[model samples]
Target: MLEKVIRSPLILIVSLFLMTIMLWSVYYGAFSNVFESVLLFVLIIALSTFLFLILFHNKRNPERKISWKSWTPYELKEEDEGQQWVTYRATRKVYIFFYFAIPAGLMVVAVFRHIEFMPLVVLFVLGTTQYGIYWHESRKYLNDREEV
Candidate 1:
């Protein structure tokens, strides 16, 4: 279970979000005070360790080759044509979502221009919505296959 969670795209998404938050805090001088500085140091160490573990695990996996020179996003293995089709469909749906979502998001940001974190809010919403669309489309395909 732990390994599955660690290998999932969910982990990558979450780690990226956390890193963004950390950077935002740093940029805003949220850790300017001594105690907060120490806390920030600890968080940096922890996140570094977590990322190291992920790298180590990826290194040990023979099937998933990762290198600094050629980085690839970790995705579910598409061993057959059917799996590839599912991925293609999911990607298409995500593209379609962005086609509509971008304009809507811009309008939302314009309306909420006074909110300090409105950009981040819109980013979070867009990210989650994209993932939701991909997951739902892929799951629907898998379910149809299973039902047959």
Candidate 2:
């Protein structure tokens, strides 16, 4: 749908940008030197913990749903059975590649190169994508709810 296409790309792009900033900070500020590396490691761990807590809170608090009232047009409807099937298949592919394949490949490369930050970069990218997907799905669900 037009709404999905428009919003999904925006979510993906924003997530990628955020991840890039984090990666750049790690590479240029922390990983470049010994003290920087330790600082970066601590910062990354703290941020990761904070993110985990936020996500957990959002998941646990079911009453706070995404809002779609602000969305324009509001013409989108619930995905039909056939469309749902296609979405399921596409989601499976995305899950397999983004969640599993990419991380596995990155792990192999990190191990072979003995570079510590490579894995973290990969994880950051993966986390970004995961967050983007969650945002997109939540938006879609909210849109559908508004329609109904």
Candidate 3:
């Protein structure tokens, strides 16, 4: 179970976010001035990410094996390997969090923490780039090619 979650890209990304939050908390001292609502929101994001992966993990990515070497987005291209429809759907669902949900959460944190909004703006841009990259790669997965 642990290994599978660790292996999934979605899980890893969310984990990175959670780690960033933890580091911030540690640096700023335990949500000392931040509202509980903000903390609750962060927890919800983490839990939802984990649950989403748990539900979809086994269902997507079938016999087609994309080598571990190409798992990193920067190293990958628009080669269709895994199940098309399923992978596309999963990619969209996950990006909703990356492109919208996480930034909203960050904005909420910024509001409560009295931090500058620029960082969340930067996060939004990063999320947009991630979505663009994902969309480019996943488009190939959206169609089925008749074997020649």
Candidate 4:
């Protein structure tokens, strides 16, 4: 379970969501003393553990250092030409997604101009969507390979 949690992108997504919530609460002055404090504590611990796990993994597997070096939403274990190709395809899709998503997000923000935190919400959505697209594409390719 710990290894799976370390490898999964879900932790990154959750952390980002938590961070967005914290930022929103701070900006709007809606932070409850108890709830927000506990949230902040959990967020800190999760991120710290994630970082530690990543570093430990790198130490245990020196060959995977390259994979850890360029961590991003679309990052994958590019162990071979085939994996690299999959990553390329996934990233291209993400780029295309952003091409449309950015404009749509901006329009939504403009429409909801009265909301002071609309930009942050848009950013959060876009960020999560990018990772979701990458994760989906990576899984699809992996599954296809496994079937073959």
Residues 5-40 of candidate 3 have per-residue lDDT tens digits of 434445545655665555566555656646445765
Candidate that scores best on lDDT = 4
CA lDDT of each prediction against the hidden true structure = 0.71, 0.54, 0.54, 0.82
- Worst 10-residue lDDT window, candidate 2: 69-78
lDDT of 1 by residue, 1-148 (tens): 4345555556556755665565556655545567556666776886677667667767787565444345454344587899999989999999999999999999999999997566776787788777778877888998899999
Task: Identify the runs in model 2 with alpha carbons over 4 angstroms from their true place.
Answer: 1-6, 23-77, 98-103, 124-148
Model 1 poorest ten-residue lDDT run? 66-75
TM-score attained by model 2: 0.40
User: What TM-score goes with each of the models?
Assistant: 0.71, 0.40, 0.33, 0.83
Q: Candidate 4 lDDT (Cα, whole model)?
A: 0.82
Clashes of each: 0, 0, 0, 0
Top model by TM-score, which number? 4
Candidate 1 local Cα displacement, residue 105, angstroms: 0.8
Clashing pairs in 2: none
Higher-scoring candidate on lDDT, 1 or 4: 4
Clashing pairs in 1: none
Residue 84 lDDT in model 3? 49
Per-residue lDDT value at 103 in model 2:
62
